[model samples]
Target: MQEVPVQRQHVGGSVCLLRLLGGDGHRTVRGFLGGSLLMNCKYWHGDEMKPTFWCKLGTDSDCAADIVITSKNQSMVWRERFSIRDNHAGKLFMVTTEGLAEGDMGTYLCKVQRSTTQREESYGVKVMVSTNTSAAMR
Candidate 1:
């Protein structure tokens, strides 16, 4: 969850919604996302951990989503194991099984909804399970 500079609006109407509030859009993934281009929406159950995203919020399938993976590496903690709540299978948002180890890196969040009162986009990720440990942590 990085590359945030949004200013949403959807209030004062019968449940209009879109928000990200302040700058909670975290970031800590691999790095170099300066141009924005990462999205999978779904299809990584080979173990679970091909997490990559920068933006892919308009393919039209109704596009409803919810995903969260977190970590800031504070001695390691198992936060946000998995997510997929209001997903209409917009391709895929997240999955779990055994990918993204290293105590599961940190800093990740994806939230998009067409309901839930109002929210259209959200992302802030930072998971690095690649130290060349033979490779395989998504």
Candidate 2:
């Protein structure tokens, strides 16, 4: 089986959706990531290890963040939590290329965990954050 290939990555702030192509039975994923914090990928139940996705505070503040991710549906799973240390100054998601506006401000988390298998992986919902700018209020 050679239809699918291994995903190669080592760059920071890189986003990818890794998929296993040629393998039988249960599979797992392993790798090291460091920049501001430790990030791990999680999936849904019945599914096994695959790939972990991480989002960090980029191009702003101290290059650090208090970013956290978790599943939106898993009310019982707590191991799917993620964190980004050394959070920078200023408003959150302010310096990021993909960020919020004056009326866009709130909380965001990515919930992911695998079922049956040990590895956790899957996509999550990013909470939309908006702001409000007014002259009289200022």
> Considering summed lDDT, which 10 consecutive residues are worst modelled in model 1?
13-22
Off by over 4 Å in 2: 1-3, 13-17, 21-23, 33-138
Per-residue CA lDDT of candidate 1, range 61-101, in tens? Answer: 32123234322222111324342322223333432312334
lDDT of 2: 0.26
lDDT of 2 by residue, 1-138 (tens): 322323444354322222333233322222222111112223333332222223332344221333433233322222223332211121011111122232222222222334555543322222222222121011
Off by over 4 Å in 1: 1-22, 29-97, 101-109, 132-138
lDDT of 1 at 103: 49
> What's each prediction's clash count?
16, 25
Task: Specify the highest-lDDT model's number.
Answer: 1
The models' CA-based lDDT, in order, is 0.31, 0.26
